[model samples]
Target: MSFVTLSNSRVETTPPVENNSDSGVLSPEPDASMQEYYQLQMDLLILTVILTGVIFVTVCFFYPLKIALNYLLGAVGSVVYLRMLAKDVEKLGRQQQRLSKARLAIFIGLIVVATQWNSLSILPIFLGFLTYKAALILYVLKSVLMPES
Candidate 1:
C-alpha cells in the first residue's frame, strides 16, 4: 500500500499496481498460461506429422515414386518450418521483438530446387509444403466444434 497527502491535509491509501510489461526481467520458467501455449505448439506439430504420414502413403499409392519422394521432401521441410516458427514465437519479446525471415528461406530453397531439378514435380512439392496449414485448419475446426475437449 502507498500513502499520499493532499494539500488540505487529507491522506489517502492505494494498492500498488502490478507490472505486466515484457520489458521487465522474465521468469526462468514459464507460468501456467505459457504451459498451455507450449502444449498447443506440441499438439500442432504432432498433428502435422500424422497428416504428413497419411498423405504420403496416399500419394505413394496413387502417384509415381519420384513424385512421392519430392512431396516427402517438401513435407519434411514444412515440419522444419513449423518448428522454427514455434521457436521464434517462443523467443518473442524476450530475445526479439519481431519474427525472423529465416524460416521462409527454407521454403524458397525448396521451391528453387524443385524448379531446377528435372525429377521433382513443382505441384506435388508445393502441396506438400502446405501440409502444416492443413493441420492448423483441422486443429482450429476441432477447437471450434468441440470446445470442451
Candidate 2:
C-alpha cells in the first residue's frame, strides 16, 4: 500500500514522501536569508574589483611622492584597523570581515602606489595586488558558496 493512499470521497492526491537520497529530484531553492547573503557577497566581489582599478588610476594622477607617503601611512593604519576588525568579526560575524578585507586591500594598494615611484619595484608590487585581488575574490566567493557556520 502507498504511504500516501487516498480516501474514496472527493479524493485529492498528495505527493509521496521525499527520500533523502533522491539526487534526481530537484532540491529546494535557497531560502531568503541565504539568497540575501549570496547577493551581498556577489556585490562585494564586483565592488572590490571596480574600486581597486579606480584607486590604482587615481593614485597615478596624484603626486607620486605624496602617494608614496600616503601609502606608507595606510600600511600602518591597516595594522590598527585589522585588530579592531578581528575582534568585531569574532564577536559578530562575516559582516566585519568585509570591512577588514577592504581596509587590508587599501593598505596593500598604498604599498603598490609607493612602489610606482621606484620603477624597479613597481612590477613586484603590482604582482602583490594580484594576490590581494585573489584574496578578496576568494573571501567573497566563499561567503557566497558556503553556509555560515
Candidate 3:
C-alpha cells in the first residue's frame, strides 16, 4: 500500500496492486475510525454495566432485597432502551428516523413513571437513566476532543 497526499494536512492510503495471476477480487480494508467508534461504544456499554452493578450492590446494603432488585431492573431497562435507540439510529440515519430525542426521552420517562406509580421508587429509576446520559455525554466529549482522522 502507498500513501497519497490529497492536501497539506490530509494523507490517504492507496491499495497496492495485486498480481493478475492471483484471484482478481479486491479485499476491503477495515476503517480505522469505524473500529475506534465501535471500541468506544463497547467500552461505554461495559462501563454502564459496571456502574449499574455497583449501584445495585450499594443500594442492597441499605435497602430491602426487593427495592434493590427494582433498582437493578430499572438500570437494565435504561441500558436496553439506549441500545435499542442506537440500533434504530444505525439502521435508519438520524435524518430519516421519525423519533426525535425529546420523544424518545418522554417515552422512556413515561415507562419509568408508570413503574414508579405502580410499585418501584422514582429516584432509583431516574438515577439509572442519568447514568446512560452520562455515558452519552462522555461519548460526545470524546468525539469533540478527538475527531476521526
Candidate 4:
C-alpha cells in the first residue's frame, strides 16, 4: 500500500473508558461502609426476629401462669400493672443497695434469666421495655411531678 493510503486507513480502535467512581458512583466492595451499614441493619433485623422468637417462647413457657393466677393476682388494671412493675424494679434497686449480698443472688438470678431469655442474642427486649416504661415515668416525673413538687 502507498504511504498516503496506509496513513488514511489507519484507525484508532481504543474506546473511551469512563470511570464510575470518579463520576461519584459507588463501587461494588462488600466491605464498603455503606455495605457494612446495610449489613448491620440486616443483622439487627435478624437479631430482632430472634429476640422476638425467644420472647414468644418465654411467654409460652409462662402460659400456665395466667391460669394459675386466675384468683391470685386477679385482673389488675393496666395502670396498676405498670405501677407494680415500676415499683418492683425500684424496690429491687433499693434492696440491692441496702443488702448487696442478699440482692446479689437476685441480681445473679436476673442475669441468668436474662441470659436464658436471650441466649442467641445479647439483646434485652424485656428489660428494655421495662426501662422504656421507667423512662416514660421519669419524663412524667420531670414534666408534671416536678412542677407540682
Candidate 5:
C-alpha cells in the first residue's frame, strides 16, 4: 500500500490507475461566473416558490377560491415558462433562438379563456404573471446594492 501526504498532514492511499481506452477525458471545472449563475438560478427558484405561496394565501382573503386558484395557476405557469425560456436561451444562445410566437399565442389564449369564464380575476392573474419579473428585479437590485466582497 502507498500513501500520499498533503500539506495539512492528511494521507490519501488510493492508487492512481493508468488511462484506459474506455475512459473519457474529464471536463474542465466550471468558472466562478458559471457557479454564480447557477447559484442565482437556485435563489430565483426558491424566491419564486415563496412568492407563489404568499400570493396564494394573501389573495385568498379577498378573492373567491376559484379566482385565487386561477391566479396561482397563472403565476406558476408564468414562472415555469420563464424558467424554460432561460434554459433555452442558455442552451441555444440568445441570438440562435428567440421565443416562438406559438408560445405567446398559447399564453394569450389561456388569458382569454380565463377572462371569458369570469371565474378568474384578470387583475390577480396578471399580477401573478408579473411575479417572476418582480422577484428578478428585486434580486438584481439586492446584488447590485450589496455586492459580495
Candidate 6:
C-alpha cells in the first residue's frame, strides 16, 4: 500500500501491484473480488436484455413496426454502451486509468443518427437507450430490498 501527500492532504490510490519476477510485469490473474464484479456486470447485461425484449414487444403491440425497430436499434446501442462502461470500470484500479468517454460518445452518435434518419423516431430510440438505466435502478432496488442469507 502507498499514499501520496499533496500539501496537507493525503491521497490514497491503488496499492503497488506485485510484479512477476520472471516477466517483470504486473500479474494478470484477477482476485476474488473481481469475480464478484464480473458476475454483477453479467447480471446487469442479462437483465437489460430481458427488459429490452419485454419493452420492444410491448411497443410493437401498441406502435408501428418501424418505431419498434428504431427502439431495438437504440437498445442494441445501449447494450454496447453498458459493455463499454463495464470494461472501463473493470480497468479502473487494476490498470490505474481514468474512465473513458467513449460510452457517452456512442450515445451521442446514436441520438445524432436517429435525429438525422427520417425513418427512425428519436423518442422511442432515446427511451430504448435508457433501458440500461432502468435495469440499474432495478438492481439497486433489489439489492436494498432483498439481502442475501
**Most lDDT-accurate candidate:** 1
lDDT score at residue 144, model 3, on the 0-100 scale: 93
TM-score of 4: 0.27
| Rank ordering of all candidates by lDDT, starting from the highest | 1, 6, 5, 3, 2, 4
Supply the TM-score for candidate 1: 0.81
lDDT of 6: 0.83
Return the TM-score for each candidate structure: 0.81, 0.30, 0.57, 0.27, 0.67, 0.79
Off by over 4 Å in 2: 1-26, 63-149
For 23-76, candidate 1 gives per-residue lDDT tens digits of 665344556666677789889999999999999999999999888988899999
User: How would you encode candidate 2's per-residue C-alpha lDDT over 67-97 as one tens digit per residue?
Assistant: 5435334433433443444344433432332
Candidate 1 error regions (>4 Å): 1-28
lDDT of 6 by residue, 1-149 (tens): 32345655766443234445567777655456765777798899999999999999999999999999989988999999999998788768656568988789888998999889898889988999999999999999888988681
For residues 1-149, could you state the per-residue lDDT of candidate 5 as single tens digits? 12365756776442222222244543344446545655677688778778888888988988788878877877887777667655554444323556554445536766787789866767777777777887788788888999982
Task: State the displacement of the C-alpha of residue 101, model 3, in Å, after optimal TM-score superposition.
Answer: 5.9
List, in order, the clash count of every candidate structure: 0, 0, 0, 0, 0, 0
Residue 17 lDDT (model 5): 26
For residue 66, model 4's alpha carbon misses the true position, in angstroms, by: 9.6
Clashing pairs in 1: none
Please give the lDDT score for candidate 4.
Answer: 0.37
Residue 119, candidate 3: C-alpha displacement in angstroms: 2.6
Measured with C-alpha atoms, the lDDT of residue 76 in candidate 2 is 38
TM-score of 5: 0.67
lDDT scores of the candidates, listed in order: 0.85, 0.46, 0.64, 0.37, 0.67, 0.83
